[model samples]
Target: MFPQSICAVSMEKTSDQVFQIIALIVLVITSQSQNSCTAKTFTNLTTDESSLLRLKAEITLDPDLTITRNWSSRSSVCSWIGVTCSTRHHRITALNISNMGIYGSIPPQLGNLSFLASLDLSSNYFSGTLPRELSSLRRLKYISLWSNGMKGEIPSWLSLLPKLEYLSLRNNTFIGSIPISISNLTNLYHLDFSNNSLQGKIPQELVGMQRLQHLSIQYNYLSGSIPPALFNISTLRVLAFSVNMLSGRIPNDLCANLPSIERLHLRGNRLSGQIPSNLSRCSQLELLSLRSNSFSGQIPAAVGDLRALQFLDLSDNHLSVYFPTGTLPLSIFDISSLQVLSLQRTNLYGNIPREVGNLTMLISLDLGYNNFTGMKTKGYVIRAFV
Candidate 1:
């Protein structure tokens, strides 16, 4: 009986040891699973790191060394220069390296950052065509490649970015016609392709963009009449087509459709025809620059209706007709917000009205090269050529 009791005690000890061994095995499995997850997370981040390293390699010059000195594998990619990461997914979200003087072609591998949203490489020296690989970034929203040396036909694939909104490729060496597919960006707000060597008519298809606010194609080689449909975009605040070869009669109903128009810079174009008298209908008009055009006829009496008018330039035009009484329109001086009023070289024949002094906000007044007489002012300096 004493031997039987000893065997029972030994069996109980063996059972406890088995239970301990099972618990140890379970802990090891759970720990391995947790480590696997951590390793996967790190492996995902390493891809982004590799992509950034490739980009750094393509960048031949970083004038400030901001990218070269900061981007290093010894440190986490999240802390690297110009990179912003998402805290939840641990993925890169934005890369804003604008005005960094980065010189080199953009590495196509950058398209591996599928989670990237905003990419600003403006004011750099990036050259060559945009890589088709960029189309991989389906989540991209804003893109600014302005003021760069990038030369190529603007990629039509840019329209494929589903979430793209603002695109500024202005002041680049991009050649070829503006892509009609850009109109596919229905969500686009501001589209600037200004100051490039791009030629071709402004795509009438762009009128499909209902959300477009600012459309600037100035200082380009664009020719052909302004697309009449562009005026239908009421959301446009600034419509700048200056310094182009655009020719046509200024649409008589110019301001009728542009309710939110603020700055209409049509200067240095070949626009002709009488200045639209309905211009005052654009109640939001602030800067109206019609200089170097062929607009004729008297300044419309409704000009004073633009209470927000700040800068008015009608210089170097064929505006010859004067008011029936042979004097400047009293309405012109009534604009209290007038700051820079330039009517230089416009054919005028009249006595300067005493009402001119009423323009208290006038700063730079140029009335030169006009057939004017009896010009006298009390409070303001005037440059009149009689």
Candidate 2:
């Protein structure tokens, strides 16, 4: 019986050896298959070719076959559909393949493209966080990845790109607070991060980005009062912070630093206090939206002074709460260039001045749920809800 036990142990050892031998055989076959693929597909691939091929391999879907069809081992990398190589160095400089409906995870291997200047992967189905390896790119200037499914925090490492000018990551699923480190991008001209799930206060450090022309962070969970320092950037043309959890009154010196400001959107917030009359200083002001806020006090008459104002919305606010008070600013009706005016549910009480008829360009006027006594006019077919 003891000899039989020894024989059973020997059989178990034999079975283990057989399993190990099978595993080794499988490993050898896999290694050989990989070697065969390399020998057949890659003829001493260049660094750029290697990185691009890795990217192509990572892609899950290519609806138009743009990348899958054009990125060929036989073809020169310079002639690739989305690639633009430098004239002297023959290195990739620009890669733009937007609106193609491609889906993939941006592989970290792409960071090897040291000379990449512009990258536009917008309107694609790309998912996953931007790889930290991207910080290695020094020459990167323009990056637009809007309308993608990218998630996770906006990496602070992005500030390392010294020459980065335009960056738009709008309409993504990005979460977490915006990294204050973004202020380091001094050369950034346009920065849009709208329609993200970003939380926390709008960074006061943004004042350091002196070259910023267009800054939009709308449709986020951003809280706290906007930094007054933001108003100091005279280069700002568009400042949109709508549909956020932001509170506190806007700075009285709002337009003082915004000399070139054309569009200002701050709707759907918890902001209270009077509308700043200093807004009239914005000579280039075209669109002003402050609806669905807690703002009170009289609608600023100074708003009428904005001759270039095309659209003005001050609706769903606590403006003119006191009855028999809050005269609908007569000057507002004097703006001939105004195309749309909305002051719905503002408790504003007054005789709609006859000057409203003078708003020849006005097409849409919404004064619903207000206290205006009368809207007497002639020769005007405006869409109004007085």
Q: Pick the candidate with the highest TM-score.
A: 1
lDDT of each: 0.87, 0.87
Per-prediction CA RMSD (Å) = 11.5, 9.9
Instruction: Judge candidate 2 at residue 107 and give its lDDT.
Output: 95
lDDT of candidate 1 over 104-151, digit per residue (tens) = 898888888878999999999998889998998898999999999999
Residue pairs with backbone overlap in model 2: none
Off-target runs (Cα >4 Å) in candidate 2 are 1-45, 321-326, 374-386
How much is 211 displaced in model 1, in angstroms? Answer: 0.3
Alpha-carbon deviation at 17 in model 1, angstroms: 53
Worst 10 residues of 1 by lDDT: 377-386
Top model number, lDDT: 1
Q: How many angstroms is residue 150 displaced in model 1 relative to the true structure, after the best TM-score fit?
A: 0.5
What's the lDDT for residue 149 in model 2?
96
